[model samples]
Target: MARLCLPDGAVRGIDIQGAQTGTVTSYTAGRDGTVTVDNPQHERALRQYGAFPANLGGRSTRGGYRCGVCGFAAYIKTCSRCGGTCEKES
Candidate 1:
């Protein structure tokens, strides 16, 4: 004998804005619209997770800029730690 199982009224509709993708292992939305995911199974799903561009304007303090090559934050034009040039103006 075989049995069939189906969701009756317990299942509710979900409104996801990123992408209609693979099964969700975890989901979270911040008050500031920040989101992150871990261990995304599908490539498309992972891309969708990071589809939104982060608003990075006015986030850094009045000091320096991050190094584009090595991702170092400093006040000087060149990063002392990684020796990378600062691309972003602070």
Candidate 2:
């Protein structure tokens, strides 16, 4: 199984094999912004649609910055919420 972290309102189409036929399935991100897929096609499709691999360790594996004032995390050096400076996370 593969775990992906989807942004809010992200959706993807997947192909699934049924008993005698195959069908295209659509999946949407849940409230926690995560989805678990067992199919490789689904994983690839989700990644193509802007979903990234989830890091279970509670830290981003992509290496980004975090806002010092509002605790927001992103790749930008400035915080979008609190208008504070963001520091690079080690």
Candidate 3:
């Protein structure tokens, strides 16, 4: 199982293939901006959608970057949403 964390109040939609069939399943973040994925496919889908893995202690891991233009936070050095430079966050 995988636990993905997003910014507080952020919402994300994830689409993954069903385990037993070819159907596509969709998932959304919960009220606290977290999603728990029970399958590897779901985990990959959530990561692709910009959700990062949550630390084991239930807090977001630090040392990532936050976009200056759109305020998106991720591990990447560049902002994928607005093509803006990202500043490292403590």
Candidate 4:
């Protein structure tokens, strides 16, 4: 199982498959993990090299987002540490 750490610190397991025509990336969540990116550059890279590294989520860097309610800094898309939703500055 591959783990993807979202900006909100939410970790998701994903199943990645590669095909000759393109690559199929599947993430695991109730239903939210089913988005497909058809970037040819990413596709070519996947075909030539491989999937993301095992340590993709090893680091914990948080920036570019903050909790709207409490103004707390967030690493994940959602504010896991603060139990609030995080939003980017507009």
Task: Tell me the lDDT of candidate 4.
Answer: 0.45
Residue 1 lDDT, candidate 2, scale 0-100: 91
Estimate, for each residue in 2-81, the C-alpha lDDT of model 1 and write its tens digit: 11111122133112433454444433334444444333333234344343323233354245577788666666788877
Tens digit of lDDT per residue, candidate 4, span 24-81?
5654333532223355544344333333322322232333566777665565668756
lDDT (0 to 1) per candidate: 0.44, 0.67, 0.70, 0.45
Clashes of 3: 0
Q: How close is candidate 2 to the true structure, as a TM-score?
A: 0.47
Q: Which predicted model would earn the best lDDT?
A: 3
Please tell me which predicted candidate would have the highest TM-score against the true structure. 3
Location of the lowest summed lDDT over 10 successive residues in candidate 3: 53-62
Over the stretch 1-90, how does candidate 3's per-residue lDDT look in tens digits?
887775443454666787778798766777765678887877876676667766522235378777888777656888877889988878
Q: List the residue pairs that clash in candidate 4.
A: 7-75, 7-76, 7-77, 8-76, 8-77, 9-76
What's the CA error at residue 28 for candidate 2, in Å?
Answer: 2.3
After TM-score superposition, the amount by which residue 41's alpha carbon in candidate 4 deviates from its true location, in angstroms, is: 48
